[model samples]
Target: MNNYEQVLVALRRVIRATDLHSKRLSKTAGLTAPQLLIMQTIRDLGEVTIGTIADKVSLSQATVTIILDRLEQRELVYRVRSEKDKRKVHAHLTESGGSLLDRAPQALQEEFIRKYQNLQSWEQNMIISSLQRVAEMMDASGIDASPFLDVGPINRDHEWKNPTQRDDRKPDPASKLKAS
Candidate 1:
């Protein structure tokens, strides 16, 4: 195969791998990578705020709020306004959230990070440089992206197998909540 064809094949494999992992995660935990990361952060931090979650996961606060809204609708997470400061709200994982999180698999990026850390520094830098170059070649370098490895709309439920098939797992309405 030509060198450019080889590059295209490699890129396709990477995209396919990410897509497959995402499907596995949804099937197992009913949560996307970002959702799992946010929930894990919430569990670790013990009743944290959305801003804190956004910072921890390197996501926008608005995006975090939207995910929390879906989780809240699923009865997984709860939000409450602090009595001392009504403006400050906190997020806590409900019983269901904790249970689901306990059984959930690690996020795709977490697995990648684990393997990435083991590589020599030079190898890591080379990989970073190569990936950045590929992004530039694809005109995707200017895109704003979170660190999560998800591919679809983060706020929507996983699509059903067939477009004509009805899914009970409808997308939740986004709540204008400052927490959860």
Candidate 2:
């Protein structure tokens, strides 16, 4: 096959893998991929605003809102208006939500994390550096990107009243149609 076709095939495989994992996760956890993603984000950053959740999940606010709606309907989470800023609404997990999380297994894709952790330090750094380089090249190519260029802009409003939420830590390119 041609180079372009080879790349398409590889990407298709990646997408398929993610889809399979999502389905499996749903069956095992009773949570869709997005729902599980939101739940994990909320668990990690207790009482977070919709904007923060959207940024964490790399989704639009409206999309996150819909996910939140479904979660709320299931009584998995509840929202409360920020007292300091009434306009802002924060999502907090319910008792049932915490219980559900306790039962859910690590996401299937998390195998990558475990495997990566087992790698030698230099190997891990090399892999991360290589991926960062690739991401930079794609970004530089003006690849029909989103407004938030990187994760930095997404979390600028980091100072929440609780002050406890903190943790550290995509794209295409066209050849001249070739030659890399």
For each candidate in turn, the TM-score is 0.85, 0.59
Clashing pairs in 1: none
| Regions more than 4 Å wrong, model 1 | 159-180
| lDDT tens readout by residue for model 2, 65-161 | 8878878867889999999999999999999988888887666546777888999999999987865665676575444333221222221221212
lDDT of 2 at 105: 65
Over 33-138, each residue of candidate 1 has an lDDT whose tens digit, in order, gives 8888889999999979888998998888988999898888778899999888888779999998999999988888887899999999999999999999999999
Position 153, candidate 1: lDDT: 71
**Which 10 residues in a row give candidate 1 its minimum summed lDDT?**
171-180
Which candidate has the top score in TM-score?
1
Give candidate 2 regions above 4 Å deviation. Answer: 1-13, 114-180
- Winning candidate number (lDDT): 1
